[model samples]
Target: MSGRGRKIVWGLVLAFISFYAFLEHDVRGRFAARQSVEPAVIVPNKALAPVMAMGFHNLWADFSLLNAQVFFANPEYRGRIEKGMIFREMIELATTLDPSYKVAYFFGHFALSSYWNNWGVRQANEILKLGWKNNFDDYRFPQYIGFNYYLNSENKNEIVKWFRIALRYPEAPRRLIWTIDRMLRGADTTNHIHAESMCAMCEDAKEKEQKRYFCERCETYTALIALNDLRLAYLRDKGRPIGSLGDLTAAGYIDKIPVCPNGCNWLFTADGAITSSSLAESSTDVRGVP
Candidate 1:
């Protein structure tokens, strides 16, 4: 191999490396370009306001990967690693890598929300902030904010406000918009029983003896619903005796709220066991309101 031959070979290698780099950069640029045109993508522009720009910036995405041991440590297992923690850190890191990655943001938000009940609210707010920073227009961010506020803060006003904002988005449905409006105006009828029944369905367990406990547990919610009806009746009549609850026919608040389709009697049992068993054997319609 003479010196000239080696020099020529080295030049050829350099040219190949340069071509490869150019191709790689071009492909990445095109991908980024496509992402930019996507409506869902939260791309940040240079013109963004300082505070908002912070949210859109890729700063905190890879918080865990950069700190390997901090993420891998699990005293519970000698050598076993905490995969959830590692995944969480990686997700955050990905978001940092690409602040515009709404998927990463959502994934991180969900993980955090699971770890902390109030996380949904915080994540919603964070995403909203990011959207605002990017001057991005989307209903999901605000909707989530409102949802978190309602679910975690119990702040009715805030929930209403955010949900209303969500309505402005083209994707938001009209029915939800109306419901939010009614709730905000306090025109929404309170159905304690229905709400309770749904909740019981969510938490009640079935261990044979405890089987159909949720179905029976609905009675409590039903009782509350009746109580709510009574309250409304007293309010509307403005002097009606509050001693007993009136039937739905007489209650002016709602016009025939949904009942359990199971044909199960929701009335109080003579023995007053106050169990969901009455409806359990009657083909529980799980979707029943009362």
Candidate 2:
């Protein structure tokens, strides 16, 4: 081609590229703005999610899991206990898309149940029950069911029932039998149980970080129990509620308020109850203690 013709073609090409870039940027900006304004919603129907995945179901499942994490991490979603957060639906879709996704089941149970004062415990239980159904040979699901029941529902019978089922599994964590024994022996509280169950869980932890977490949790629970006992004594002696951890020190209940190993301060509830700030609302160590 002639130089003039080639220059003209090059100019047109540049113009087209610039226009395409501008259009793409505008479209992306509008899409982002729309996403920011729209409420987070999930397709609740599990059966439809696979169809939506269009043969990339596992990738879709992974996307759902990541999306759930993002949704939970959003600052706007924090401290909001109301339903329709789509956490449950996202997890449900994930597990439906890939039934063998063990992490999804575990994360779904932990996140939902621990999120808002056991508000999602029932939902977590549903996920766990599905996990149990799909992964029957794995004992963790039944064990989780027992723990959730014990911590959230305070249903002794259900706790025992699920624990027994867990124990029956060959792959059950060794802590299951200990938990059953403790529960049967009337060691309903941490004081009576001696943190053995917690320690067992810590020992059973496979990852170094998980082991550290469980050990720290055990220490925190033990500290909470001791603090609770002191608070009870103060209540009995003074005939009033303990206002704060300092009150325990001021009243000569102890030399000083014990520090939580988790680095969170102990919380003194208005009802004269002592709890750990680090523990979740559905934690067995936090619940049913005075």
Q: What residue runs in model 2 are displaced by over 4 Å at the alpha carbon?
A: 1-38, 42-45, 83-85, 180-290
Highest TM-score among the candidates is held by which one?
A: 2
Write model 2 residue lDDT over 104-177, tens digit each, in one string: 99998888777755666767788999988988788889888887876675555676567656755656655555
**Candidate 1, residues 116-182: lDDT per residue as tens digits?**
4554446546654564454356566676666566557555556655654565566665455434433
lDDT of candidate 1 at residue 158, scale 0 to 100: 62
Model number with the top lDDT:
2
**What C-alpha root-mean-square deviation, in Å, does candidate 1 show against the real structure?**
16.0
- Residue 190 of model 1, lDDT score: 43
